[model samples]
Target: MNKKTQLGVPLSAQNRLFVPVLGASGGCGRSTTAGLLACFLAAVGSSVVLDTAPRLTSPWPSWPTEHGAGLASVPPGRPLTRHQAHAAASRSDGPAGKWSVLTDHQDWSHGPLDLPTDPAAWYQLAATGAWQAVVADTCHPVAHDIVAARTKGQRGLTAAWCALPFAVPVLCAPTSGTGVAALQTAVKAITAEGLPLQRMVVVLTATGEGRTPPVVKAAATMLESQVSAVLQMPFDPHIRVHGLSDADRLARQTVAVGSALVSAVLASAHHTWGDPLPPAPVPAVLSRTAVDSRSARPAHHEGVFT
Candidate 1:
């Protein structure tokens, strides 16, 4: 494979690639997949994981971060500067690489966070950050979102992300009969809406250690010709016990699964947009003395937030 292909580089510096990992249903390892995807992508270029899950439910705020104001600090309606966007994100480093996470930071004692419901607003905020890749951990059920968007004339967040240019969606499901059924339904709905089914990657995640379920194996066989690729992610005990707080503790096989998923995403983008993906231009901010002082240091030397 070409180095560029392996890295999942964007086709243009101006065109940011958005990878939304949408689950067929809840408890489908959506957040785990998103975090790992961002980790691997960060190895090649600037990347961030946007926690699109609702307030109070997102796991990002609990994860360790270098520095950030949290997503709640983002001002509404005003244009977001790259500095502002970067500041609102909590940065973290691990074995895979460095990546930032933007998620709700409000405490339960406070009133509910007023997160933007308009999908365009979220996209704009991410684009303004100038991140090369964005891994969105979408919370809603995607098949239902597609139906709602089509029938009610309302734009669903997952649908909007999938429709964006340079999008490579990862649809996840558990390796169980019910999970496979939900995934099948989601694929059908995505296809019916005239979306890019060819660019979709289906991930069947194991919730616990066991042999591959017959239903999951059958689903993979049937979906092989439909989507971009079908991958099985083995269960990681660390994630089950401690959640995604520490990437370094993730099992090696789990990390390998993430690498495969990233490769599939890059291949999908290449097929959809035709590559050698153009190299991203250096950000003007890097030319400034202050930005250079902060960003020019070696990755390992950067200070970590306790």
Candidate 2:
């Protein structure tokens, strides 16, 4: 890696969060949801997006070939100076404020590619007050390992998506009955892994879709009884690889989905930290309530990780 010509102080943060988006399969929209959610989180307030998608190049935005350190590139226990941490993260135009990405370093071909990042490192970085949230785009088979590593021995971590394989059997089920059954089976599978069902929120996305099938909605309704929340991704034809576009006009409905996701994330944060989120912009729906219930305090383990 080449030396960054302009390293600077990290942005001051009022609080921090870590949201890992995981799915059972590749096309489950985990990365897309994560990227967009990260952008929305940033637009609403200060945040850092961590791109851990196992791809040749990031599915979100591309960091310049001559770029600074990736968040994953930081060595264990080696604290980053404010400037170094900022250089390690950047936005589309250049290194800037809270709205930035810390992509995987391009050297994983020979290193540990499938491993989840160390939670201690993440904890240390979060402790620095440089970001309000760290949204991670991750996939399964490996996603569980990441969750286990992060959750190991740490109680009440306030992390979301515990064992949410994010399966879409319902999406392919031939009938409404089959779809609901499939979703139930998938939920059972996740619980068998000893993951807290209450911490999980299943998000369903579509392909070339303008509307969700009635069967799928039925499946989601069934899932709502089993999990804390169930969300649907709004189909937007304009979604691009570069990132969630601020330049284009997003539909009112799509904006609502983003708002719900933000509130869910905040609810988890509040549950874990036992404190109100710092001042940040919120959607109209969320301004009234953040989530269905003040997420019951840390059901998995005692004491919060943050």
User: CA lDDT, every prediction?
Assistant: 0.77, 0.49
Candidate 2 residue 65 Cα shift, in angstroms, is: 14
Candidate 1 lDDT over residue span 1-306, tens digit each: 543445554345565667989899878999888988888887566789988777678877887457589877776543346777888899877665778999877777877666766555566667668787888888889888889888888766777888765789999999998999899998998888887888999899999998998878988999999999999999999989877788877899988888898888888887887776544333222223333355432221121110
State model 2's lDDT: 0.49
- The residue pairs in collision within model 2 are 8-83
lDDT of 2 by residue, 1-306 (tens): 111211111212444555666554445666667655655565444666566555464554453223556655554333344465666665642122225666666554645444344444443443342565566665443334434645684422222233212111111122234444544554554565555556556677665555677877877777677665777776666654333534134456666776577666555555544445443221111111222342432211111111
* Model 1: ten consecutive residues of lowest lDDT: 297-306
For each of the candidates, the C-alpha root-mean-square deviation to the true structure, in angstroms, is 7.6, 12.8
Candidate 1, position 12, lDDT: 51
TM-score on alpha carbons, each prediction: 0.85, 0.62
